[model samples]
Target: MTLFTVDPATVTPAPFTDDDWAFTLLRCLASPSTEEYPPARLCGFLFLAPDRLRLYFGTEPDLPGTTAADVRPGGALTALLAALPSLLDEQRLTKTDTDDPHCSRVVDLTGW
Candidate 1:
């Protein structure tokens, strides 16, 4: 797993794991704070690229909770979340943080 670093010493860094990212994504999705993030919605779609990950929701499919009735077939992100916890490549989980305006913290788990 990779390690996350916070600007403030009081904040604990998140251990690099798919589960960690998934949880972060989940919390971000459920929150109403948009100032820190770019223009996007929670249900629109997820953009997972080599350099960045962003979730947008505008006319996009909303992610139902695991108990919801309309869960995606194969559980989509849910299934991914489950599978991600077991990822073996520890080095790949590294978090590359940058001051770039486009993406501040990008986790590149491409090969894994």
Candidate 2:
């Protein structure tokens, strides 16, 4: 019987705004029983102008390229939270960092 505790402030969702970029922290898990849905969760933050998104999954995350088309889905946290449903719909899955006990995930809100 263990309860998880992440600072409420850290988990808090940002407001939906036009200029916000979504920085999602996805933890991909493997299904043992071959479940169709698999197990996953979406944890992340949003960034506005003068702010940006940076993520570290032990390894560095891929920054957006020059093309906005490829960068839209991975925008600021505010934008991501607002369009979370759509990202899930498009990707057809969600992931959580809890799947791994030793995995350290860091999402940095920097330049936007």
* Predicted structure with the largest lDDT when compared to the true one: 1
Q: Give the alpha carbon lDDT tens digit for every residue of 49-99 in model 1.
A: 333344323311222221111111122454444443233122345333544
TM-score of 1: 0.25
Q: For residues 1-112, what per-residue lDDT tens digits would candidate 2 score against the true structure?
A: 9998889877878775434323122222111234554222323222323333322212223322110111232344345444433333232232233333333322222222
- C-alpha lDDT of candidate 2 relative to the true structure: 0.31
What does the lDDT read for residue 68 in candidate 1? 11
C-alpha positional error of residue 102 in candidate 2 after TM-score superposition, expressed in Å: 15
Instruction: Tell me how far the alpha carbon of residue 73 in candidate 1 is from the true structure, in angstroms, after superposition.
Output: 21
Deviation (Å) of 27 in candidate 1: 1.2
- Lowest summed-lDDT stretch of 10 residues in model 2? 62-71
Each candidate's clash count:
3, 16
